[model samples]
Every structure is written in C-alpha cells, then in structure tokens.
Target: MLFDLPDDAVLYTALLARDAAWEGRAYVGVTSTGVFCRMTCPARKPKRENCRFHETVAGCLEAGFRPCRRCHPLACGSGAEPSVAPLVAALEADPARRWSEDDVVARGFDPSTVRRAFKRQFGITFLEMARLRRLRESAGVLAKGGKVIEAQLDAGYDSPAAFRAAFAKLLGQAPAKFAEDALLRADWIDTPLGAMVAVSDRSALHLLEFSDRPALPSSLRHLLKASKGSLGLGRYAPTDQVEAELGAFFAGQNATFRTPLALEGSEFTRTVWQALVAIPAGETRAYADIAREIGRPSAVRAVARANGANRIALVVPCHRVIGSDGALTGYGGGLWRKRNLIELERGYARA
Candidate 1:
C-alpha cells in the first residue's frame, strides 16, 4: 500500500525490500482466490494483475476479500494497529455468545493481555465491551418496553443473576431496577478520544465523565450516592441533547447547549463551574478568572480545585481553564489531550 504518512516509512521500506513490516499493515488481495493474505503471507505472490494492496484489513474486506486461512489475517494484535481487528471480528462473529474468560483463553490469548489491548483501543475490556454491547441491545429492546425475560434471553444471559451482575457492573444498577422510562439515566458512550459515562435525570443532566479521566469512578459513585440512586440510563433526552451539541462543538459548528445540569457541589463550586462554562467554546480562562467570576477573587486555588472536580467534561468546560501565566495545567484527561483540545478549540475560534 502507498501509505503517505511518514510513520509508514518502515512499512514502505519493508514492502520494497520484502521485509517484515508489511506483514500486517499492508495486505495482498489475490484476485483468483478472492482472499486477502497478510504481507507475510507465505503463499507466492500472484501475477501483478492478480494482486491489490490495501492499507487496512477492513479495507480489504470492503474490497470483497475474505481472510486467507494460512495467514490467519484476522489474528489479533500482531499488526501495527495493535490488533483490534481480531476482537472486533470475534464480536461480529459471535455477538450473541456469552463471551467469557474461557472464550478468551480458547482464542489462544492471555485474557489480561487481550483485555489491556482491547481496553487501549476500545476503552473497555473485551468481555466488558461485549457486555456493554449486549446491554445496549437488551436495553434498546427494553426501551421499547420489551419483557424483562425477552431482554434477558436476547442478551444471552442464561440466568437472571448473571444478567443483573453484568448490567450492574456496566450500568451501576440491577436490570430489574432500570426505569423503563425514567426522566434520567446513565449510560456509556464511546468517542474517538475515550469512553465516557454520562448520567441524566429526566429534565437535567448530572454527570458526563470519561472513563480514563482518573477521578471518574469516584465522581460517579459520589454523585450516585448523593442523588440516592436516581441515576438510571444515559439514553435520556438530556444525554441526546448533550451528545449532539458536543458533536457540533467538536466539529467547529456553533451550537448552544440548553440542557439542565445537576451540579453536585456547594454554592462556590457551582459558581466556579458556571464560570468555566462561560469561558465560551473556543476561548479559555485562568483559575483566577473563574474565581473572580464567582466573586471570590482570593479563592483561585479553590476554583482550580473545583475545576478539577468537574464531572461533566466539555459541557462544564473544565478543560477550558488553564494554568495562570498562560500555561496548561492539571487536567484529568491528561495534559497532552488537554493541550490538543485547547488547540482544536483555538483553531475553531480563529476560523
């Protein structure tokens, strides 16, 4: 494949010299066999007319090439992309199966290693990701007011306890306790950056934190406990509103979010969050600015602390607050992503 990125230098070199780098990133699709093999495919290269190169295995599949058996083109993680192809393929292959540790083991993989790899790519372990997929499907069926038994059967749960356990572990509540049409609910949403856990109650949103944001688990737990377990699914109106607005915001489109937010903080902290949101889509502010906005000029440190405690990400706009003296500071999403986000926003503003 003619990958133009400089990072593909090694792959090109490998391809030119018949070296090893081409083993994964580039695949050879054989016309006669209608199967694609990895660069390291042991089969002799077909005539020039019979071979086509693709940058990704998915691309090859789209080009109508089924995987070749000898090369095991779908084998997970031996590629440059870190092998999400296998896990995804496995899921697509057996979406209805109750994937387990034994399933992981039977695939000739160390569950932890596979877990970490999938988590790195999909932001959840294979089992957990599968569980979430199952939950979403089941939840959708139940959202239409399907019977609990039908939802349980559709999710591949042989027993009520197992289904409840998976649902609780992922959704933080038992399936039976799920409100069929609650005003608010919490759910997991995947984005290009990472996995986010969003919570909403019927007229307002309460939480939206990334899973890898370090303080997410505690922040969510605290909110859940304080709200006395009113949080249900993240599929409510507020979540849809926030998700769409966020998509627009990320796309550099001008869209205002008007959803009600359930801020879980004292008066000062709420004021700080309000200032944070007021920083605007593409602009930023210092902790001192937030403090001043809250009419507590001397509480800059407290403002920073409150900013750090923010559970809602882009909505609360905590990432828009930078260090004093124009430096980027502590962000739960990691400083690098924070910088990138600010840069992205700055570009949006300038354009």
Candidate 2:
C-alpha cells in the first residue's frame, strides 16, 4: 500500500501518462492479455476496466499475470541487464562451468564491471552466482534420488569429499546422507531472490527457509529431531506443490498455496503464526497491530518474538509486518530480501 492506489481512476491516469514515478512503485495487471507491466511500460495501454493496479510485481503475478515482454519489468535491475546479459546467458547455458574472475576478463568483459553489475542486479558476484548455479544443478539431481557420486560429478566438483563438504555447508547434511525413501524429504527451490530449502512429509510441508540463512541448519535439525530423525533428501507432493505455487507467486500471479503445513511451536506461537497467515498479501501490519489482532494488546514484544520464531517464510507472511514507525524490521532472511518481498508484494518491483 505504499503507493496507495485505491482508485482505478488515479491508477489509470498514471498508466496513461506513463508515469516513471509509478514505474517500480505501481503495476498494471491487464486482464485481457493476462500480463502485468510497470506503469512506464511503453506497450499500448489497456482499457481501465481491463487494468487492475497492484503494488508489487509479485502481487500481479499472484493475480495470474505474467511479466510483459515489451517492458521487461524483471530485467530492470537484474544481472540480465544489457551489459551483463551475454555473460549471464553463457553461464546459464553451461551452469557447471568453473567460472573465475580471470575467465571473465578473458571473455572481454572487465572483471570489476562484471562484478559490480552482478552485485547490483543479483546481490551476488558473478563467480558466486556460477557456484550457486552449479550447486542448484547438482541439488536437483540429488532431489530426484541420484547417487552422491553422480551429484558430485554433475555439480562439477572434482571429488566426492569436496562435494560433500560443500553440500553439507549449504544444506547441513552431506549428499550421501540423503536417502531416497526417508520419511521426510528436503528439496531445493530456485527463486528470483535466491534459493530456498523446503522440507516436507508426504502430506504437509514442515519447513521453508532461504538456503543461506544461518538458522536453516538448526531449524532443519530441530525438525528431524521432532520427527524422530525420520528425514532425508528428496521431493514430496507438498514440496512440489509449494514450488509450483512459489513459481506463480514470483511470476506476478495470485497463487493461493493450498499446500498443507506442519510446524512445531508453542500454542501461543501457533496462534501468532496463524495471525500472520491471516494478513493479506500486498498489505502490512505493525507488530502492535498484530498484538491487538491476537487479543494480546500488551504483548507487542512477545508478538515480535513469535514473528521472529516463524520458520515458514512467505507462506506465513511474517514479512508483512513492519516496525511501528513504518521502518523495515529484522528478518532472519536478510533485510534486503524482506524489503524485496515487501516491494514485490506491493507491486513496486526491481529487476
């Protein structure tokens, strides 16, 4: 609600005028074409009736709209920018390639320029992005019941030990420990923001956190202990469903995640989490607001504590809460991600 476009008239005026002021802050989801574009998109304007104003690109995507190709909204600040696109494309086309700073220079791009572009667009260096791509490539195989050695080779790791160490560092478990038939399974999900880890049983998702979160390992360990160590690595129905819903969510569609969740927390914490789920997307509430909603008006600090304790990220909508002063608050996931999620939901998108 940052841009606060409550009326179609006002939104349409901005759209018709191609207001750059609303470019990232406002989006128009065109019903006829089933696509969303920034307010500054040069595509012919749709009728006001076919236009639905959204606060974030994610909001548009959640409403079942795709990004408009002409405007290329997702490319604005992404590593896919004109200067960096060729290198990004090359890396993506061969994700397992061992990328180095020297290799970038050899490819006729200045290493410093490439580094800055990637850092600005993806919040990661080009080499780091390459490494993550390799990990993702390998992890996908592991998630589908591939052997440890196979995954190691797939990721371009030189040896089993190296692969195991890297995989363990990222997932808190070595590749060999990932049993195909274990009761609970962990899967990797790629997103525009970064990678996420999803652990699920047959019927419900138990954990969802950004892979880089320092707390992820401990959280997964807790879930394993709670389930009596009946955990492994692979995909489940819930993981698959959530991934698909996440795809829609990132694409600017209204994706209602019907995937069931199974989280372990105190009764009070559970109540707070459910309250978070009740918060609508594209909107935010203060911790005090949540405390009041939960009928615990004096428990503002407790509400913030419970919010921080939430393990499920987007599904729980904990990011929808801000500080009482309207400033962004702490998120176990980087505050940058929190800000991005807020803007994404509010239709103020970045590349």
TM-score of each: 0.62, 0.68
lDDT per residue as tens, model 1, 1-351: 223222233433454456565555576666566676777766665655455556555445434455676776656353433445666677767766788989878867888888787655434466865665466567656656677788888788888888877666655566677655554676654433444677887678888876456676566567667766555553777887886676556444653677789888888888888887778667888988877777789998888888888888878888888777998888887886687578657756787
lDDT of 1 at 77: 52
Model 2 lDDT per residue over 1-351, tens place: 323454567779988999788866777777667667888899898987567676655445334455677886545445455557777667646666667888888888888888887666645577876676577668767767788888888788877888888888877778786655688888766555556889999999989998888989888778767777677877789998998788667656663678899967898899999999988777899999999999999999999999998888899988999999999999988887788788777652222
Candidate 1 Cα misplacement greater than 4 A, ranges: 1-89, 98-102, 110-132, 147-159, 181-183, 187-191, 194-197, 211-231, 234-237, 292-295, 325-330, 333-337
Q: Which stretches of candidate 2 lie over 4 Å from their true place?
A: 1-114, 117-123, 347-351
